[model samples]
Target chain A: MATALENANLLSRAILTTQKLRISVSKTFNHMKDGIKVSQDEHGAPKSFASQLQEDLFLINESFIELEKLTMAVRRQREAETIGNTGALSMDPVTDKTPLYPKALETYKWATRLREHSAHSQAFLNNSSIKRSSGSGGSPAKRRKTAPTNLNISTQAVDNLVMNVNRQFHDVKITKIQLNPTVLQVYVSRTLQAIIVLRGLLIERVLIRAHHENTLNDDGTLDLWTASKYEVFQKITEHATAASLRYYLPTMQDLSFRSFMHWLNSFSKLFSTPCRLCGKYIKDNLPPTWRCFRTVEPYHECCRP
Target chain B: MGVTCVTQWPVTENRTVPQAVEVLTKRLDALGASKSGNFGVDCETYQSVPTNVPLKYIHVMHNKEQPYTCYAVTDNRTCLVCENSFEAIMHRLNGFYVPKKTARIESKGTRYEMGDFIIKIGIVSLGPHARGVLVEVEYTPCVIIQDCWPLMVEFMQGFMGAQYTPNTHPMLANKQEVPFNAEDTVFQYLEQFENFVKRGSSTATVR
Candidate 1:
């Protein structure tokens, strides 16, 4: 704790010194314009200040490294304490010798390759003038209808792989599926609508936004995350996850969903009750009826009654 | 930080401004909505003189709810919802902006509150002539338009009846996830006020 405090103090002092050095460097530049020759070696003070700035910058870098080490140490300690408490609920380590199910591995590989296809398509788009001839006022309906089938062979293959993976979990149903050359939008059961867009072969960015039965748009697509909608989803999911830990395990940095069903199964935890409003541990009880249409917080029928 | 719905109530045959408001307020009160106070929103329009700067209107709107802020949209399509010092900033740009068409279309009526829902029924006026009614319904707890629209519509229906059916507001289109704020609410009212101005003289229409 004392070392952490010392590291923090050093970080702040280093930052302040860097700021002061920056001001002096700016002042020195101004002095150079005011007819003061920079090569004034007799006084040598201005040159010393420039050198001092370089030294200050080096100190700041060192302090930042020290600060990062201190923070990571604290985080590791907290994580260890948590793991100790939740002994049975430890995350599945990726290096487990047991090979993943053949279908699941194939699906994962296909999804991973989507990132590369998206990049290649993007490069093709950039190099080609095909979009300019398409006209600016091209409607969305037309865009969907005219989407070239030849370009989406990889997309269809991945879609089939994803659908097959979801078929493994009995209750997890995928209601709608739309595939573009670079993006896939999937409506999973009733709880979540996920849009997976590829960044590269390494990055399959999955944006799972909230979906509602009544609020479905004319296009039959869910509204993407806005700041407010994301907050509402986050709050409800967090509250639900806190109430029950069995279904929704915490996500790590890698964020690789095992299968479509694996991701869909987590949404069931959002409806887990003992009612977030009443805060009673009602075992084997019926799910709360009335959920806040926006936040999706479940409440007892009697509470909202 | 909340979703707000703004719609105009076109005054029709046999119904006076006060009578329409009273009827609506009473219906709201009956439905457990309590009166908070009176509320008003106003806008001032200015144009830059041609000799010094470009010819365009600089609209600045002030809302009673957000007293400290001013929503100023310039001719260049730049919008700034800034502090009370916005007037001083305008004054500094004297060569650029000169008052052209300043219409102080205001809504003066009672504010009502019920749980997370806030309803304001105002008799909008231009000078002495009562133009129409402006009803603003807000769901304070929720920011997503998709989440709050139903509740707002339900609340408005209780008082407004069949006349004020909520439509897809053009300003709110493509703004599903964007958390509606005070600036947006004022902009919607300004839009309605602009439409009223475009419709020519309110007294002429009434006559």
Candidate 2:
């Protein structure tokens, strides 16, 4: 009677262990599914998808190991039940050494540890990857942080420009010089004013002209028209107008030569033609297709068919 | 650059405007002051013909001593001492600003020089009528108002006597501790001229 009762007690304990393992296994599977969903959802960038998939695979392997342990527990529980039903007095010595409850506890701990590991790795990866992305590229978040710094840089650049201009034409007194990032305006003595747009160190678009009446110099060295400064300014103006330097100027720091060349090629035939229909000068301000189809002459929007 | 104070002298008992000017001149001459040149500060008020915009005035004050610059006060109260004359600037803004009232306040008297203090006693006139005496005392060496105010008061007291105590003009009253500028001097003159105009006397037309 005592042996039968002990066997029954062992069987019940095994059954209880199996039930707990089953519950824990189901819980682990649910938690793993949730973790994968969380990782997938947290992937804000498309480039992180491959790495997220690898993490998901790793988590699934851990979950499979937990599932395997739970299945082995259930098999042991079945064997113990069968042994108890057959009224066998002696228990399996190996089973007695490693009880179902202790092994189930171990698997449960492993499952929880795997879950925590996945969560910790996900959090660490999210932070490190975000830092890497924001550090290098101009994401909206990164751009917002750099906006004030960009303004400071531009103001400093303007200060540098004024200092350079002062050094360049120290002989000619500059009455006033104003700079707002891209454009630098100078009002100098001798009725000369210059408006300059700089793309890096290169002068992209510039207009230098005499505002007042052309007076002879105090020493009678040169008149306004005969001055080398006037000649150089005129040459620059002619070059700018002929080449259409206005369109060539880029406000951004990085100048893509290929894109600029492509634009030049595209817009090559779309300039400097007189309108046949209206018999007026065609300005580049209007569209290219404003030219007549057969005549190859530009026309006003109203005059064009 | 130096501290300048403008004050109106009280009309004396049984003394005509010219007589008062004469007495002040004699006193100035007694103190070893000499006639330098005539100085005039005239203001031409202009009301905008187009409605909604406020009335604007152009005060053109020319010091014969400083002949190179014409100190013209446009709508912006700040004095623009331009190289161009008042006539040139007025000609440029002819259509925009039409002259309404002209305050013809002229100063013709001895400029007393006693140490750092320079004093001018002018019988300020309104066209034909002599309005009052305009006394201008300047501390030539002092750029700070607080440092020079006491010395200026003492000098003025020596000539003005105990009967009249010269109060610091409203403009200088608040900015006593601050470093003086050319604008502060101009502002004092403008304020005195404005008060003289507000007395509702006969105003002359500026040609």
TM-score of chain B of each: 0.87, 0.82
Candidate 1 lDDT over B111-181, as tens digits, reads: 98775467888888776677788889875544456544544565566668856687776545755456556
For residues A3-101, write the lDDT of model 1, one tens digit per residue: 556656766766665665566556555654564445545675455555645655665566556555545554222122222434232333552553343
Predicted structure with the largest TM-score when compared to the true one: 1
Error of 1 at B201 (Å): 3.4
Q: What docking grade applies to model 2?
A: incorrect
Runs of candidate 2 exceeding 4 Å displacement: A1-305, B34-38, B50-52, B74-76, B202-207
Lowest lDDT block of 10, candidate 2 chain B:
B198-207
lDDT of 1 at A189: 44
Lowest summed-lDDT stretch of 10 residues in model 1 chain A? A245-254
lDDT score for residue B106 of model 2? 58
Pairs in clash, predicted candidate 1: none
Candidate 2, residues B62-151: lDDT per residue as tens digits?
Answer: 664466766777666867777746667676776777656445665555566654456777766656667788888875544555544554
